[model samples]
Target chain A: MPYVNIKVTREGVTREQKAALIAGVTELLLQVLGKSPALTHVVIEEVELDNWGLGGLSVTAFREQNR
Target chain B: MPYVNIKVTREGVTREQKAALIAGVTELLLQVLGKSPALTHVVIEEVELDNWGLGGLSVTAFREQNR
Candidate 1:
């Protein structure tokens, strides 16, 4: 079984995008490892920028400083 | 801020598995890194065995008991 958990900063990702991501991951797993799509599981998590951090700074602050 | 995402091949994991994993991970982060449980997010994704692989063999085929 292939389980994939994708974490991304939440920024209004559409349902279609989520579906495409799941499908793409499934197809890629199948092609690369001969896995079955029916047995693949893909989960997407949308995290607030404030909840994500890099180098001890929240993603919110990181983006602000970068800009 | 700490966000934890766990992916596991699904095989009828119990409710205890969900609770224990989330709680344990949360506690670990708190103890090790001083992350607040309130700010921590834990998500678990379960994949089917047929989709998982090792050394180019699907877990389904890899398991002799499955045959």
Candidate 2:
């Protein structure tokens, strides 16, 4: 059994969207990895925008710098 | 970015085992899903023995029932 955790920026996503995303990912895992959905576990966490970083830059800063 | 969460019975697993499990699962995802490790985020949570249930039975009870 594989357990998966998902963390995302909560600002742009709705509760329904989050649920759909989880379900979609779960399906993807089953379809792609040949794993059983019932045996898999998924958890979602929403983190603050400022806390997320990419390439040593905060997501906010990365967006601004790229823009 | 695909974020994966892993929840496991932490009782029998050591800290090193946990880290290895994460790395193994992460590698499995990358190898199986063609995803970038940098883009994937994984979180591991250890739940109490009483909290995890499988097939409508708690892990503890399931083991007992099976045995």
Candidate 3:
């Protein structure tokens, strides 16, 4: 059972994009590893910019700095 | 950006095994999708069996029933 959990910033992701992500990941696993899409699970988790960090800076803070 | 998180029951998994998992996944992405190893990240989370569920039952309960 291949379970993929994708975490992205909460930046107004549309339902269509989420659907595409699920389908694309499922297809990738199927094509690359011959995994059955029926059993493969793709979960998407949206994290707040305040919570996601990069280079010891929160995404929010980083953006504020860059701006 | 490719960041992968793997969650498994807290069954005393060794450090070497976790390292192998990170390396294997990184290699898979590199081989199949041509993702750069430097950009790929793998995080492992050990979950409590009581918190994980299967078939509407906690993993702990499921095991108790099956035994």
Q: Which candidate number would show the highest lDDT if scored against the true structure?
A: 3
Question: Which scores greater on lDDT, model 2 or model 3?
Answer: 3
Once model 3 is optimally superposed onto the true structure by TM-score, how far is the C-alpha of residue B54 displaced, in angstroms?
A: 7.5
Q: lDDT per residue, candidate 3, B1-67, as tens digits?
A: 3577755567776787667667766665565445578967878777788887768998789989999
* Ranked candidates, highest lDDT first: 3, 1, 2
Clashing pairs in 1: A1-B49, A1-B52, A2-B51, A2-B52
Residue B11 lDDT in candidate 1: 71
Runs of candidate 3 with Cα error greater than 4 angstroms are B6-67
- The residue-by-residue lDDT of candidate 2 on A30-66, one tens digit each, is 6544547887777767777688877888878987999
Give the per-residue Cα lDDT of candidate 1 at B31: 54
Instruction: Write one digit per residue (lDDT tens) for candidate 3, span A1-67.
Output: 4577766667777787677767766665565445578867778788888988888899899889999
Q: What's the TM-score of each model vs. the native?
A: 0.54, 0.50, 0.57
Q: What's each prediction's clash count? A: 4, 5, 0
Candidate 1 lDDT tens digits, A20-56: 6666656655654455888777777888989878878
By TM-score: ranked, best first: 3, 1, 2
Candidate 2 docking band? incorrect
Report lDDT (CA) for all predictions. Answer: 0.68, 0.66, 0.71
Candidate 3 colliding pairs, count = 0
